[model samples]
Target: MSKKLNIGLVGFGCVGSGLYDVLNRSNLIDAKIKRIVVQDPKKERSIDQSYFSFDINDILNDPEINVVVELINDSASAFEIVSQALKKGKDVVTANKKMLAEYQAELIPLAKENKVSLLYEGAVAGSIPIIRNLEEYYNNDSLTSVEGILNGTTNYILTQSNSGIGYEEALKSAQELGFAEADPTLDVDGFDSKYKLVLLLKHAFGITVAPKEILNVGIRGISEKEVAYAGEKGYRIKLLSRAEKIGDQVVSFVAPHCISDQHSAYNVHNEFNAVVVEALFSDKQLFYGKGAGSHPTGSAVLSDVSALKFDYQYEYRKAQSNGGLKYTTDAFIKVYIGSKYVNAIEEVAFYSVEETFQSAAYSFQVGWVKLEVLFDLNLNARKDLSLLVLPDSIQTEKGLSELIEKNLFIYENQN
Candidate 1:
């Protein structure tokens, strides 16, 4: 029999409130929100005031509260809350991806030292249950790569853009629908997906990598040219988070990629996320779910709470047995670069050129470029350029060439 959980829920935001509502409504788990700590106690809430508290120690000091669910938006403060909770001998569940990605190296050890479970299934792909799956199911599998649409806000915006909607308008709709935040830079600029990717790398490959070390290019500057190309090429533009193990080293990045309908993530859209995992024996597997929303994320947090009742904690089996796998940005990837200037495409010494398209309005080049070189270009190069990775299973010289040989490029001259 499992022990009843006394949960201290911090931050009554979307995910926090959603967890509260779900936990109260469901009898599936013998857990209750003993106390909720919020920054603004003055803010009106649907629940009674008796359940709320303004101090952190109200729950931390109370020995009865065994679980701390931190769902705050502020990453810095969240780190503090999680750290203190673990030190106080309370298991923690957090939905803040940024905090986890930034502080996993420190936090994970802290949890282990204190002998408490710190789970964050809600941090990565919302309701996907990916963290648990990677920890338990795929623990023994020799995973080669994990890639897919990891951000629903950008995915939703991109899906809306495909329906002839402008980027700003689509973003506005996502914001209004609660799929995106009021300030969408973290989503639009690709930082959110990048943070999630960091967590994925840890679980999928047992590698600890700083988020900044990964080359991240978000969907910030997506234009009609790329959208039109996708429509014409029968492809969908998605911000993909990819990490692949090559030999002893692993390369990872989060960027916008052009994917065809044959791909599993092609149909996943509008606040939905899909992750494709490739193992030596398993071949290919896809996990799809609602990646954003109050209830979806809350449900994930609730799931973590239930697990705590049974004393279920991740063992990180791979991390223990991992043979010093290295994380690297030093790689090569095939990409489609569209720019207003021809020099932008011609400037880089590409590994190999596959196809090039030119038009009166804009132009694009398809070729292989070194990962580090491309990462620097995206960071320091011209802001007007848009880079999209060409969808290919194998990014090797022969494999990329074979894939590109099957494509047809059409050059349009409006003059």
Candidate 2:
């Protein structure tokens, strides 16, 4: 029989204590939790830590500890903890999604060099195992489309769309349920799904574009009327985190889309999440589960711990692996970036629609739109007058005619 692995937990907050709960029940895996470490000494006094230490050095310096679990929330400092652990040849299992989302570009390679597994099962969809599924099961398959209810807070907020409740009331309900943090800007503003998308890009498609590159849209602007209209039309409005390979470009965004009963993700309500994958071989695959919860998320971290606890034997003897491939963002999807920040400025001598934004361009899309720009020499010079700069693609007479027909640029496009 194999011996139990010695483990260390970094954060003793909601997630850290939950990890201990899940590990105690794993019948197949035996682990000796050596110590739960903390950076702040006050935590040492608050919690019973016969095996706890305030210094990080205690975990790294210990010769018996084989794996370190980082449940810390801060991305910048958590990065340091995981990196230092790898340098010392200790495997790492983390539930810190923000750190991985922001720094997976640099961290994955470091894990390979040290021959230590950096497993993040709790990052994407709680305990649903989206990252592991993409890395292991979808190795040979080409994933074409990805759409999911990635944010629990936003989902709970928008559930009120059907109830006729306002945004403020919905947010209060979410806060009471503990689905949202004290500062809900990250989840409500779409930064949470943006980070999860980065993790998906790294593991599933092997793309490591910066979070700033992808277009992010939150559900805040969606009005109550929009939700009611969606139901009236036999459809539902959901805040979707999506990444699809459109030819040579990766089209990824988070927004509320109108969907009918044919869509599986529309049925994923509340804090439960779902991912719809359009694979080349298999027509479609749906992964659904609780996207966030103390116990569920902690169980996900335990899965990673189990993987790391036995990874040494799996790689050498069992031929077991989470095989991940690498490819550039352009390899699978073309990034549609307009050189000029103008999508509209069509001068038809009579009509002008795109006179709003001259500073920034809009996000990429699959739909079609056109708007004409009427040049008024007196009004064009002023910044507020709406004379947008045009690129060569829409500078011609024929382009102006098309722009007048579609009338797309009158409203605000994705910023």
State model 2's lDDT: 0.66
Candidate 1 lDDT over 63-127, as tens digits, reads 99999999998999999999999999999999999999999999999999999999999998998
Superposition TM-score, candidate 2 onto the true structure? 0.76
lDDT of 1: 0.86
Best by lDDT: 1
lDDT of each: 0.86, 0.66
Cα lDDT of model 2 by residue, 208-227, tens digit: 76776654556654555445
* Clash pairs, model 1 backbone: none
Superposed on all Cα atoms, model 2 deviates from the true structure by an RMSD in Å of: 9.4
